[model samples]
Target chain A: MSTTAIPTNTKWWNGGRSPFNASYGKVMMWYFLMSDAFTFGAFLISYATLRFSLNDWVDANHVFNAFPFFGHQDLPLAFVSLMTFILIFSSVTMVLAVHEGHKMNRKGVENYMILTILGGIAFLSCQAWEWTHLLTGEHFALTKSGAIEMLNTTVSHNPWGHRISGEVLTNALRHTSPDVLRSMILEHNHSATLASLKDLNANELISKIDLNEVYVGRSGPAAFGSYFFGITGFHGFHVFSGVVINIVMLAKTRLGHFEQRGHYEMIEKAGLYWHFVDLVWVFVFLCFYLI
Target chain B: MSDNVMTAAELHMPHDTSAGTGRIWKIFRLLSVITIIELALGFGLARHWYGEPELHHTAILFVKGTMCILSLAKAFYIVSVFMHLGDEIRNLMMTIVVPLCLFIWFITAFLWDGNSWKNLKNTNAGSKPDQTEQVVPAVIEKGAKE
Candidate 1:
């Protein structure tokens, strides 16, 4: 019998270590991502369940219809599309960085990492703009008796619309001279006059205007603000953290740390985290914006 | 050779099997195309091109389904290609994927349960369910009576 005895002390035969044939660090990153995914999943599913049970939830289309600097042109889904593209492009840069890292191309890795970091910063800026616009914009709440009430919305109560009621116009008319008001309306080519703003009821006022030009308040399910802030804010926090990590990674890359290590596994690991962040955003986009 | 030699150029050369820059760019283009399509659908379906847009139950359900599918596809591409999960060993892929599937199932179950909670709260505030009528009998009828 020429059969050799099976080796008992070999590295591969060690109990329960690297059973998945991946590096320890890589497997650990996967585990962390899995847990983080659960946290996000719980938040989104709760949002959906609550939204479904509510009789009068705000339509996402109406709430997220604004674009940057376009000044309310009814440009629905445009800014978010741009935001989504930015994140996706950042993810591409991340993948390219990892690829360059695999080739042991130090300069390529550094360049791509820098691009990825810039993309992250851009996405964060866009998100900041969206949040600022949301918090500072005009809002209105529909009252029980069919009259629209202007609301200075805060974190607790955001009815998700811009309804400048007849009272507001009336107040504007009172504040400004007739010539100035006439010039303002003429400059904007608005059909409203100071006389018309004086005696109109809320319904009559709403009827006289084009709903697209004015912000029409949706029937908000009471928990809309809570869910919107909670889920999107949590996701935004992740994006911010991811950007910080990417900056750190970029610094390490430029310092020749990965090059000295003779492997770009660190870049690969960071790329995994970045891609996971993007993945979470996909779900968030669907839950908050699309569905 | 000095034992302090830890420089990258001194390290043993390993085989580099990563795809070329061109291939990476190609994948990027594909991802961009898919995302643009999703954006078109999102904008097109929501806008009132005609008159007042009605939110029919079936229409809402269809749009929701389409959005979910597209989002999942985007996630799949990013994970499998960009994260290189698909290129990993089968055991490794299973280690990540199986747990994720279970997590998704848990979310669905919990969400359904939450909807039930909302329904119960809305219909009968502070009223306890009749255990004999709604709970025990159901358990017994499901063949746990023995």
Candidate 2:
């Protein structure tokens, strides 16, 4: 190939055109997402590593069984599936916003962006409820001294452990402190006054308590709660930031910034980020909630 | 100003808005279906409503594997269609994709090492004498005293 035979247009790296045939901003966005992927990948892989090394783990189904408005019903994986759909729907809206942006339809963009933002906020609210529930909702666990104690999941603690057999629970119940017994009885019978319940001896309280209502288990590995909070908290932070970005994008769109600039590429960039958040949730859902 | 300009290749790239929107919804439906299937499998296996009780362990592993594959499928659709990565130039796609292959090694190495560590801990360093119970030599003790 002589120099004269070479086509100038074919020299992609010759500096006047983009080798990727994409805007610099879009390329940078993709690179940022790629790096973000690695960050999440490392976190999730480390989670898997810890999980693989452990002899026992908290079953996700048991931990995530609660659903809003269902009280104490055992609806495993129900709430998270709803959250997943909310996120997926929001992703659809975001893509629609981008599509409308392509057509220069400001109204369509505004509507879809609003929907997308609402979806994000709704998902965040669900996460908040979930975190609060896990942190506050009490469960029975067998302590090291063979006493049954009421505890909730926190970053440092996990209450979803091996179920205490009926016999073990009966034995452990006798050894439990009066304070724990009162609380456990109160949990089962909300109508009873704390002072009255506290006045009752351990044996009397144990007699009043129904063994079937009591769900006692051994204390689970602490890492379960830590990983659960760490990874989900990180993902929630991403969703929060994505919402902030979308709000900024929405404001810019409303201000006609893109119109004046002659393109809606900024929205496209934001859409890429928003979609990436949804993409990460797919894996997060799989890793944390499903399996 | 140069950054805002579309290149020759980009100019030639198809912009089929109508078809594109249709495909987006199609992919959305596909994603939702896949998610639903994953959740069904997850819920069913978790509740012991599917598979034989004798194969419970294998059933869980199988379901987990299926969910992982389905999650990858969802990721692919999100990246390819929703993010418009499929429309990007081949070189661009390769740039984004090739580096992701590292995850295979990253996950395998970490998990393999983790499992090995578990084995090591469980087997007490593969048949070595219990370090805690090893007796200290009296000669060393005497030398330290001196």
Candidate 3:
């Protein structure tokens, strides 16, 4: 009977030096994705923690709404459903590109990669528009509930929501209301016209309104807007950078660099990054749109 | 080779990453449709069409649990076949899925604990623990306060 000696060298390449011998770029990308997944998981988990901990947080619908042209109504989280489908579609295309890469099909890989990139750009643009809407104060309502009676009414506010633009506001107020009109308008103004009250931007004509009466965008405490802006803004930055990278990759593909390489590693790498974006949006959509 | 373009068939797929992504894709498609059905069922329950919020809540709990599991199945298909994580060592797959599971589990516990604590503080919402003081025990006499 002979005893076998244990081999000392085990790594595919000592510390993964030989990229080809090792898992190549794809496997390495998976490792990065794992760690990145953890980061996103932490953020999403933290969001869940914070959201659950809060006693008086804004309901998702009250916070997010459809586009300006989409009936201007407080739409449910349906738009996010569309966004999710788009991302999943992109991910599928990316997977197809990876499959093609293995077969050494450059043009086919390029076609799918282009489609995936387009999908990514569309998702990011949607996110950007969403963030801008939240930041610039659109499609949100001010709901008030009397603590003692549980009597709730949404005093339609938002200084920006006024159909009366600056020109219109100035025109409407051109003739100060008579004693009765002034009092009625003043009461309605104090009660209803909310965004006007919290005048962060002095540019708007309503900045002329009394400061104490207006609180920026109806929800209690400024933490509402702060968290909304902070998280979505951060995600927007990711999308922006992702777009820049995708654009470069797209241009490189158009120049036939991937054709020479006989592999779609560039496309695959970009796909991984695009998937990360999609994953982040899932969390964002769940938190910001759903419960 | 530079001039030779990749074929559409090759791009659609050439290698079998796992059992069959085609089959897997079809399964996922079925799963997604089922999920949509579950979602509607959940909504139906929520609307009290089946009667009683408690019953509805319990139904939703199972429904949502099913949805979550089905979603994981989708991920498994993608990772195992598409990403070939399944082809990796069994231990490696566990390395990914297990940790993710533990994370979700612990977070669920934390959320429940936090909710209970909030309800405790409020003296409203869900039921609270005993507020009455405990009576001093007549010593067991075994140790005499030792």
Candidate 4:
């Protein structure tokens, strides 16, 4: 217990500083990001397995065809491309903020932080639009009987690019009242007649329907809806938290908090988190939208 | 305590007058150009503009491979430059990077396992008849009028 009691010649442990030469907080943040990366990686791998498991899956090009105000155009990958640019641009601004922190320029830090915050908000809004478009829009499936089924997706069911079984339709039909069935068909623009309804013979009635023509409510796999919502929703939550972290950092900067600490390493740490969020988006873009 | 107090200027960090501003702008331009190139390739070749039909499977795979590589490149730039990971001490770099490499390995292993599961489900002899066939009826068997 005495200082220098044993004079060891080994120059092993350094004192009073981190061996990594980085702040403890920054290194911890990296560790957290790495673990978070694994979570995302697992989700994506699950998506791939299930997607490849199916004989046919919804193509990214078809699934994400909608754009803001354009209303279901074939502008494949356009909106996501813009979102990618915006996120990357925000990463640039974050780096600038960190650089300004290094220079002790409060104004530069504030300005770049503001830009980064705006970019984060814009990205979030775009994602909101994307989610709303996906969940609320019309989806179609080609039934096993060669009849098109007009479908709406819930978290539990997605009909896009998957075939609905005749049994599923027949079973659903058995439970549905005739009035409800007729109204559902008319609502979704399926040209079913009361004569077909009165027949009570689904196979005979479905035979009268045209091939390649759409009908209403035949269940398809829930995998697509589950994965899409699960993965993107997770990423969306990360973006939301990143924005919140940035806003807090911005408030502290405005309150002269970092100046009181004699360095802006706090800002640098926040910048690290922001950059990590943007980095995750790049992968999400590739997995969900592009590839 | 007074001797322990190090001034910001003494840290020798970049100042307002340094060439760091130019470096930041250069990185911004590089990122933008790479993104634009990725977008163009994705739009033109993958989507098949100019009267071309959809790409062949191999061609589509090639495009996807290119996009993945480009995305990794973008991630590298953002992490190294924006996060300043490249400028950090080697131990610090490894502290972040080595674990991430394991993360990638985890994904690859799971993806390969998942693919095997898919292949197993698809080809195994004892499996139930392929659902693809039963999913949609080829022809509706009309019953006698009841």
Across A75-113, the per-residue lDDT of candidate 2 in tens digits comes to: 999999999999999999999998898778898899999
Model 3 stretches astray by more than 4 angstroms: A1-24, A138-229, B1-74, B89-92, B98-102, B124-146
Quantify how close model 2 is to the true structure by its C-alpha RMSD in Å.
8.4
TM-score of each: 0.76, 0.87, 0.61, 0.77
Ranking by lDDT: 2, 4, 1, 3
- Over A54-134, each residue of candidate 3 has an lDDT whose tens digit, in order, gives 343454444554664685565645555556677667777777777666666667677877887787777777777665565
Assign candidate 3 its CAPRI class.
Answer: incorrect
Please give the TM-score for the first chain of candidate 2. Answer: 0.91
Give the 10-residue window scoring lowest on summed lDDT in candidate 2 chain A: A1-10
Query: What is the TM-score (0 to 1) of candidate 4?
Result: 0.77
Residue A235 shift from truth in candidate 2, angstroms: 1.0
Which structure is stronger by TM-score: 3 or 4?
Answer: 4
Local distance difference test, each candidate: 0.67, 0.82, 0.50, 0.68
How much is the lDDT of residue A233 in candidate 1? 85
In candidate 4, what are the lDDT values of residues A1-291, reduced to their tens digit? 012222344332454335555555767888887788788887887888776554445556656766898964678788888898898889889988888887788999999999999999999999999888877776544444444444566687565542334565555445544444444454434565666567555454444433234344334457878888888888889889989999999999999998887789888878878888888888888787776
True contacts kept of each: 0.49, 0.54, 0.09, 0.47
Model 1 ranges with Cα > 4 A deviation: A1-17, A144-147, A161-219, B1-18, B48-55, B114-146
State which candidate has the highest lDDT: 2
Q: What is the DockQ of each candidate?
A: 0.25, 0.28, 0.09, 0.29
Model 4's A-chain: what TM-score? Answer: 0.76
Per-candidate clashes, comma-separated? 0, 0, 5, 4
Poorest 10 consecutive residues by lDDT, candidate 3 chain A: A146-155
Report residue A119 deviation for candidate 1 (angstroms).
0.4
